[model samples]
Target: MRALLVEDNDRLAGLLVTGLRRAGWTADVVDSLDAAIAACRTHQFDAVLLDRGLPDGDGLDMLRALRDAAPPPAILVLTARGGLPERVEGLNRGADDYLVKPVALEELVARLNAAVRRMRGGRRGPILVGRLEYDPISRAVTIGGVPFDPPPRERLLLEHLLQAMPRPLGKEALEERLDSFERGIGSNAVEVYVHRLRRRMEDMRAGVSIETVRGVGYRLRAVD
Candidate 1:
């Protein structure tokens, strides 16, 4: 999942970004409300890790704006202020979840996943694409009821594409998302993973396919 992190503390933000990336998520960090708002305007995030206090203004102000976004991201507030009243106010304002400062990466990720699951109507099951199924929680892949384990990079590539199923993702965007997970990617890296994934799909005789759009990018499409 791709997220936007609204934090002012450099150390904390760096740690959050690293941990999030390690946990199979891509996040962009912003230190102020203005930057956060600008990011919200530009891109759609799966979630937002917001800090209550910021250099410019209270992060809730940005939250107010984001609440108006179409299909707004799940907002997870990470704040030092965790009084009951503060939590209530945040919730009333539109936060999906709230976390106190100095939180463990594990808990943060878990809560983020919970919020996303709630946003998705509590779906934590396999993602279906024709005859293929990809489970986000287990990082497991299955084709025609047969188990298949894709390499780490390959798995991440497929997961990313599947997350945006039915909609083609730009080649450059897909490459950026994959690079956030593993580095040293060559120019044809996306092609290589796609090719391997295709082979696996055929091996299982699955009805799923990743279609390449000549000038745009690739999309996960199910065949009849």
Candidate 2:
């Protein structure tokens, strides 16, 4: 999943970004409300980890703006203000979930997943397509109930394709979702991942195929 992390503290933001990447997330870090707003305008993030205190303004100020986004990303308010009224205010202001500071990475990720699941209509169970099964939370891939571990990039590509079944995901969209800003993404990067994943699925007889949509992009469909 892709996330926008709005935090001013350099050290904490770095740690969170590393932890999130380790947890299989592509995260973009911004330190101020202005930068966060700009990022929201630019990227299509699945969620936003918001810190209340910022150099320019209260982070909640941008909450309403973020809420206005089409298919708005799930918003989680992370702050040192743990007061009851503060938490209530944050939620009332359209935050999906609220977490006080000094949170464990595990707990943060769990809560973020829960929020995302709720946003996606509670699709928390394993996704089954033909003989292939994927557990979104665990990011585990299984074929005919046998565990299958692909390379990390391939795994991420499969997850995105599964989530976007039927509807083809454009190359640009796939590239944006799979990579972050710091890295220089190659033009054929998505194609490479797609090819690798397709080969693996075919070799495993997973009964699914990655179909190229010609001018569009790619879609995952069950084989006849």
Candidate 3:
């Protein structure tokens, strides 16, 4: 798994990075909130290990910005503030998990994996259902283990839908997730992608189905 570690203490940061690597994960370490935000935008990470104290401001500031991100990565606050109020505040601010300092590497790794497991609904691998699988890492889809590459937008649309499994997603929500902040979406854009994706799935005889709820939104489901 890929991670972004935002901690100002040089020695601590190095230790954490080394520990993460030893645990079989690659991490990019940044010392400030600004660098953390920039790295987040430039790179896609499965989780972010955040320290509450930074030179510029509270790391919670970065947490707020990240919550607004599309498919926001999992966030785990690793700080020295162990007060009950502090833990409550961090979780309320959208942290997937929170850990106090002087934590063991084994416990940290376990907690991080637990956070991701909760986000993924206990699934550690791809979003799999019968013959179809959507791999989050590569943004790749396979049916009966056969590779299927949809158009870029359609591919992203599928990933978003699968991530939100068992929840019917509205058009407005899909548009916000797929479109860049500066890009204005056309009225029929979402419908077109949905329609195309549905047809592609049909033609492939895939073991998945996209269901449209009248006056509501679309949902992806595993079929028999």
Candidate 4:
């Protein structure tokens, strides 16, 4: 999952980003409401963690704008304003959930997941391609009902491939999707991960295969 965290507090933002990444999420931080608006315009995010007080104006203003988005992202109001009235106002203004400051990392992640699930209108069944099965909500992948756990990045790569299906995902697109602002990765990073994941799939006798398209990228195809 990808998230946009609009927070001016550098320390808090760093901690939240680190925690979210550890939980298998990609997160980007923007300090002000204007930056958040711009970031949202340029990148697609699964969730947005917003703060009420910002350097420019109230975070609720952004929430108002986000409600107009074609497919608005799940918004969580994470601010120090813990009062009941503030919480009510946030929800009324289109926040999927309102969480106060000093929240637990685990709880925050859980709430974010819950909010997203709610926005998605509950969980959908696992994606099945040949013998490979992937549970989008749980981030679990299996083959023929057996457990399959790869390293985080490899798992994410596999998910992207599975989701895209017949359409090949370009190498540049994969690199951008896998890249996080906090990490400095090599230009050939996508190739490395694809190679590792492809080898693992082969070793497990996975029914699906990663087919490389020369001058293009890669696609997942079910073996006959």
Instruction: Say which candidate scores most in TM-score.
Output: 2
Angstrom error of the Cα, residue 194, model 4: value is 1.2
Candidate 1 to truth, TM: 0.77
Clashing pairs in 3: none
lDDT tens digits, residue span 104-173, model 3: 9989987776776666566557778657887764446898888988866677678778878888889887
Candidate 1 Cα misplacement greater than 4 A, ranges = 128-132, 137-156, 164-208, 221-224
Candidate 1 backbone collisions, by pair = none
Can you write out model 4's per-residue Cα lDDT over 52-83, one digit (the tens) per residue?
99999999989878877767889999999999
User: Per-candidate RMSD vs. true structure?
Assistant: 3.8, 1.7, 9.0, 2.3
lDDT by residue for model 2 over 116-190, one digit each (tens)? 877888767788888899998677889988888886667778889998877999999899888876664699999
Error (Å) of candidate 3 at residue 102 is 0.5
**Model 4 compared with the native: what TM-score?**
0.87
lDDT of 1 at 70: 80
Which pairs clash in model 4?
none
| Model 4, C-alpha of 17: deviation from truth (Å) | 1.1
Regions of model 2 farther than 4 Å from truth:
none
Query: What is the lDDT ranking, best to worst?
Result: 2, 4, 1, 3
Model 2 Cα shift for residue 92 (angstroms): 1.3
Task: Put down candidate 1 lDDT per residue, 117-188, tens digits, no spaces.
Answer: 788777676789888888876556788878877766677788888888778888787776665322446889
Sort by TM-score, top down from the best: 2, 4, 1, 3
Better of 1 and 2 by TM-score: 2
Which one wins by lDDT: 2 or 4? Answer: 2
Model 3, TM vs. native: 0.56
